[model samples]
Target chain A: MNKTLHIALSGLNAIDSPGPGVPVARGLREASGFDFKIIGLAYENLEPGIYMPGIADKVFIMPYPSEGIAALKERWEYILSVSKPDVVIPNYDAELLPYIRLNQWLKEKGVASFLPTEEQFEERQKYRLTEFGEKYNIPVPESHSVNNLSELAEKGKHLGYPLVVKGKFYEAGIARSPQEAEDWFLKISHKWGFPIIVQKYIKGEEFNVAGLGDGNGETIAAVAMRKQYITDKGKAWGGITVTDPRIMELTRHFVTKTQWRGPFELELMKDARGDFHVMEINPRMPAWIYLAVAAGQNIPLATTQLAHGEEVKPMPSYEPGIMFIRYSWDLITHVSSFQEFSMKGER
Target chain B: MKINPNLAINDTGFAFDPMTGHSYTLNSVALEIVQRLKQGQTEEEIATGLADEFDADPVIILKDLLDFIEILRNYELLEHE
Candidate 1:
């Protein structure tokens, strides 16, 4: 009989702004050489993944990271009491710090998580993107973190009008003038908080690579995609794999420099002159990760294996032209399930 | 307040409003309150019932119910009386 490994996953809220949990869980289910049960960690009862019957063998609502480590640890202890997971994969940015901090304790309990070193996680932060590029010798767009709204005018003039203004975490808007820059700054600040980024606008094609690193300065798998359809919020609604050796080389260099140990997405932009600049680095898998699995690489599964200290082979190559088009589906579920989960914190 | 006729909420806590074509998921407690409201339960009944049912503090239940009702209104699931 194949031994079943219990795996816990978070970021299951598949919605307009989706999370990476569902795709990661699907990849684990289809993963080669492993039989597993999935435990879903969710923040909201309404997160669609909780209701998706087969994906999660069981689901538990976790305390928000904002509730502080004590509450989070207590929740995890309760979850571990019910089921001992072999490994836990946290798929949200906000939840990452807690998981990373709890890594050693989780290992003491036999749960492993392949995550980046604290320095790696902190260096690649959106606010520190410039430092990342300079340190790694990767080409990155000139960007600065603005502390006050007044700085928008001075920075806009230097970077030229039409610079990109970005929130600390998510949302990026291009401002064509000083007025527009300040307006975007206020909008993004209001939603995502301060220290916004103003970047040299590279009016070019956007491409991304969803990759996994083995923590030994080698990329275990990498797949590049050029977004074909983008939503108003700047997410790829449809995207296709591309045959680009440049992105592969860039990814290798990045992995080698940082010795990054887990899944990551590199957002890049190609200028009119065909030069590519790293736009941002997402510390976790992108929501369109299933596309990489379809093309030829199973990144989420690979990361899971590496998490357990298993030796992994570098994926050979993937077919170009593989594509994914994301769409919304209405999940039909009963209120009782919601009540059971909410009242009991588990379902 | 009344539930929009075009809205359908299943036991799984999945809510759909055909008028807007936007679907939302609800927590278990929130789903129960919505169902209670649909059944024409008064705020007092809901507050008291939820507090008793969940073994929660009454003050917290009252606050939560009001917050959820406001959310329902925002989602267009609640019709203003």
Candidate 2:
């Protein structure tokens, strides 16, 4: 009997619908013909099976009731022992820390995992990335992480009007006027208890580049896209495939400079000067993995194959003008709120 | 609402705004709603027509139609008459 290669995915909550990891498993099955299993923790009802058929042999669910690290680690250890997967891949942002902590344990159990070394992981986080961008002549928004209104006001003056105040972890964009920014900071800071970063809003076209990197800092394959439509809450609703060699070179440069390993998504903004500013880096798969595959580059499959010590080749040509319209059920919900606003002449 | 004369709708549900080179793709339901609105059909009449044409519940179809109409209006694909 052939040994099965089980790929375990974390952060399988229904609320994080259409998780990025789902497509990775799907692509792995399609490209390499492997037996995959998914281990997800659900906070709510999630249809009770794998979203994509045949991608996972079985899905094991765990109840996640608290936000403590200890609770999460305990659950993770229990799931890892039960599944005993060949490789463990984390699908969400917060799961990275715990996954890194258990990296040694996973290695001892003969399961492969990809993460930065302990020192590198801490150095490449959001704050350090921002600082590194400045050092390398890479453009980044003027940002300051603050915890109080007094600090926010001082930072707002430096960043100018119409700044964005956002949590350091997990929370998305929240753009507001200086006063509103301060007010929101006070409210959310107390609730989330954060070191929130406030930055000057960059008015420009947004682009994202997703790629897989070897542990030795080699970019195996990559895809670039320009966000054509965005939701009010800052999710990319629709995106167009872009063919800018400069963007690709910049992405390669950033990844190599950071010496990053595993899968990564680099968020960038192009200013009027045509300079690509590095906004942030997601050290995981992006939400548009399917779109990237549709555009002729399958990063998920490439990552899996690369992890298995396979030599992956790059595409000589890709469809440049291809575009994707991401239609989610949530967009239907936005339609009703839009109608109510238009009725009141508020839009 | 009325269809903007400046905007062009192709048979394949490709929408083009001549003013701003922004192109959009509409699904089948959204395409039908836009077509009906262009033909100057009332919301009620369009809802009834959709219900009759597709094998779907009338109440759910109407709700979907109205919601799509609202999106079209926001995108300037429809103009209030």
Candidate 3:
């Protein structure tokens, strides 16, 4: 008999640089032996996922995490009383920490979530990546965190021309000269915050691996892909599954070492020397996670199962050469639907 | 000396490498050389055949064939040694 599970997830903004919420919901809906009632949690009224047909069975407006944990908890409490979700998946990086803080509360309320430990999450931060690499014996580009423009210029000069300047939370730009480095510093700092990261840049092809860990040093699922086409915003528009044993080994090594508890994506670069460098580690699934489902490993489904405390055997293999080309669709919806969600915070 | 057995060469002279998912378009001469290579023809045999078919010098055909094979190697379309 199939059991119906209520799964709540966030990150529904399906703009050019999409969020994983829609794809995650799609994967869950495709799972066998489980019927899912997807509840889309949105921070904004027009998240697109709210209006996308059949994507979310119910929609709820969530308070932004910056609004404080008390507000977030109050909102979720109301949601639990009404919807009674079996599991909640937070698909946005900015919201992960807040969700992690609420994991125990959710568990006590009979809602489960799979999230990394606080220590694990902090260890993988962008500024701490070099430290993370050294501790784990992984190869990463030499990086330094700078507080001000002078520090950035000095480190940028030391790292040589064409180095990478990165904001605290997001945004990275390649600065070919110290002048360019200062420009990026001002631009990114104005948007994000202080303490930018200056790192050695390795010119190479990028590869990504989406993986789920069992939280006990076991990799439940992993799929590697290379972007065949990239957008101006550095998002993958078209990608293909690849069979690179080295990348697979790296994924296993990362999972085994960290015992990562949930969905994670590893951004890697293969340099001219054929060596893989750890570029960044995103704490949640990538926007293109549906490709993992198409390639034979349903990562989102596995993650949901793990969160529900079900046993998930390791998915050790997947077919390569599977391609995914993204296309945009114009969804038509009436203004009243948006008004209902905006006015009442539920739809 | 060997091409990937899994490569799909279509009638439009387009080739796809199944291992890496990289695709390329082949010109007429390059397509002929790839087909001959797939048929287990050696460098000298492929050169001789191309020369007779196109009425070109065998020396020039062999030189161009070697260059094309080097490109195939760089693309990883050639099987590993």
By DockQ, is 1 or 3 better? 3
TM-score of chain A, model number 1: 0.97
Top candidate by lDDT: 3
Evaluate every candidate with DockQ and list the scores.
0.01, 0.03, 0.52
Q: What is candidate 2's CA lDDT for residue B81?
A: 62
Better of 1 and 2 by TM-score: 1
Using TM-score as the measure, which candidate wins?
A: 3
Q: Give per-model TM-scores.
A: 0.79, 0.70, 0.95
lDDT of 3: 0.90
lDDT of model 2, residue A106:
69
Model 2 chain A worst lDDT window (10 residues): A43-52
- Report the lDDT tens digits of candidate 1 across residue range A34-120: 798999999998999999867899999999888887898888888888898998999988778888888898899889999987788
Give each candidate's interface RMSD in Å: 15.8, 7.3, 2.0
lDDT of 2 by residue, B17-45 (tens): 54333579988877888788778888888
Where does candidate 2 stray beyond 4 Å?
A1-3, A11-18, A41-55, A62-73, A173-176, A313-317, A329-347, B1-81
